[model samples]
Target: MVKGCSLSQNGSSSFPDPLLYRQLVGRLLYLTNTRLDISFVVQQLSQFMASPMINHHKTLTRVLRYLRGNPGQCLYYPENSPLHIKAFSDSDWATCPDTHKSISGYCTFLEDSLISWKSKKQTTISRSSSETKYRALALASCEIQWVTFILEDFQLHYTQPALLYYDNNSVRYIATNGVFHERTKHIKIDCHVVRECLQKKLFHLLPISTHD
Candidate 1:
């Protein structure tokens, strides 16, 4: 779970027992269902299931140590929280040393309470940071739309254009700008779903400093 730590399948001996590593990673994956903080790290560890290495085991132990040190930590929701929806999305572009795939992470809030979150690697490699970020935004937007539908089913209505925060200005520009350029044409058509949501006033994209 160390910040800026990138794991790879290079320059390390294979673990003697890959089964143990797989079992441990499976448990960690289950933990991520509630432990959003560990989701990214667990996703990174899962990539080595086919052949885990010594360094991977070391990193897994570190995650276990982190869990031990923070046994009481958990996501909490308060009763009577407001029904407004907001989301934050980000991606680490081409961070996977083996496949060179990007990792996307997003968290959704019902007012001030965290309600949903995810961390997963992109299926296809992104050629630019903007593309990677835009893909992340698209994923977050889809989740927001689903959440909005569920809320409606329960008779909870929120204001139009739910707020979505991203650190990439280019992505915000792409979502709002109608024109497409050669640089953006290569991006998958499915990823443009965010722009459709924007056109429908489903969500407003805002730029934020990465440190924020």
Candidate 2:
């Protein structure tokens, strides 16, 4: 349901009655607590909750229809799965229609089960692809730290330097090396934080080819 809504529309609500729309959207957000599959879609819908338009309502209806059709479909965590933690992250460049801030999204898994994830609009507008990718890495770094803390609470020990997999080599390079090109000077904060995390051995970015 929420999955369909997320895949069906980009941001920018096309509907009306923003107050009512936001109320409904809020319900969806609340529902995401137990519905990890809907997290991405709920996050997408949340972006338009402020000033929903007619199109937004239509999109929301589509999500409802999808939910109606697949009420039984939901994420399942295996009881016997191992406690190993791993994370994957991706970002879209300048995805916002208004401010042009990129959207950073990532999902964390405990063995085969998803534990946490988010899709959010970045605070600073990025000037290039590298900046957006770096922002996503930094955001993922925060998630890694939280997950590590959670693991510690449970008395589970994940090896130091949690693995973070990304598809972009340039982003990987920025984290692995400190060479500051003129293009990435504007994104100094993101680069610095990511590098710091890397240096601390809190997480290491693993390069994966796009097709792989």
Candidate 3:
């Protein structure tokens, strides 16, 4: 998908054959298991499978061209890679022009290798960017838990805290600050998992620049 591009369900001429669109999108969805780079675009494109537009198919073809150019791209799990878990999370606030809902996405890495990831819209409207980010953080926190548990099952452990990076400064302050504030009350429920993970030293939250 294009940067800052938000596709709407309505408008544009509908594709003549929805089956072809569905088949192409389905194939792309399967590829996302290893082709993490195209996950976001594929997710966006898949939404219109039932009734794709010419614009959507054009975007899909663009993705196909990019994939053809990078045939060797893949997730590599090296034996020398450490077992530490690091996660990155972000949200596109009010990304959906129609519904005005946000989208939260996250990726979990086992040391230097990307092991798991996701890109999906939020379930509810976020009142602030902080809330959107914090919710994303919570989702990432859950992924970290599963990663750690699975690592433990394999008798592997990293003593250091699992590092979580997000681009929101408000999330950093909200997660770190214990003080109760009226501004944060509405989002208190969403912050619970993240704060608990912090208290237990499960994750070390870090704020990053989106531009970076």
Candidate 4:
């Protein structure tokens, strides 16, 4: 999908064949398992599978064109790369014009190689940008925990906590501090998970500039 392009169910022109749209999107969704670059766009297009519009079809064609232009693209892991796990979490708050739900995205790397990533809509609506960000952090924490477990099974262990980078300072503070506020009450339970992960040294939450 193009940057800053937003799609919704409210488009004026509907596609002629919903069946064809669903078939094409289903294939693209399968492709995302190995093609992380298309994951976000695939998620957005999958949302309209039930009733795609003409504009949605055009968007899907663009994705296909992008793929055709980069047929050799694939993830590569060098044999000598380090095994340390690092993650970056981010979210677009209330971005869905229809449901008002945020979109959460994260990418995990083993050294310099990208191993796991996701882009999905949140299950619940968040009242603030911080809440949405914290939710994304929580999700990333879960993913990191899973990755660590898998590594442990492979007899690989890290001496330090996995580094989790985020662009939201409020989320970093909420994960480290024990204080709670009225604005954050609804999200306290989610925040607690991240706090517990921190206390156990599962991961270290840090703030970074958005451009990085």
Tens digit per residue, CA lDDT, model 3, 1-212: 67877788877898888899899999999999898899889888977877788888889889989999999987788879877889999887887877888888999988889999999888889987778877888899999988888888988865789999988777788888877423587777767888888899998988765563
What would the per-residue lDDT of candidate 2 be over residues 1-212, giving only the tens digit for each residue?
43322332344545646788888888888877777666666776677766666766876787777777878976788879876667899898875566677788888887778888887878888878878888998899889888988888988886757778898888887777656533477777777777777788887688755563
Q: List the residue pairs that clash in candidate 1.
A: none
Q: Which candidate number would show the highest lDDT if scored against the true structure?
A: 4
**lDDT tens readout by residue for model 4, 2-74:** 7798899986599999999999999999999899989998999999988899999999999999999999999
Give per-residue CA lDDT, model 1, range 1-212, as digits (tens): 67777899987899999999999999999888788888888888999999998999999999999999999988878878877788999998898877899988899998888889999899999988888888888899999999999988988776667889998877877777767423487775744688788878888888765553
Query: How much lDDT does candidate 1 score?
Result: 0.86
Error of 3 at 94 (Å): 0.3
Worst-scoring 10-residue span by lDDT in model 2: 1-10
lDDT of each: 0.86, 0.76, 0.85, 0.89
Clashes of each: 0, 10, 0, 0
**What TM-score does each of the candidates earn?**
0.93, 0.83, 0.92, 0.94
- Among residues 3 or more apart in sequence or in different chains, the pairs in candidate 2 whose N, CA or C atoms overlap within 3 Å are 14-53, 14-54, 14-55, 14-56, 15-53, 15-54, 15-55, 15-56, 16-53, 16-54
Rank list by TM-score: 4, 1, 3, 2
Stretch of 10 with least lDDT, candidate 1: 181-190
Better of 3 and 4 by lDDT: 4
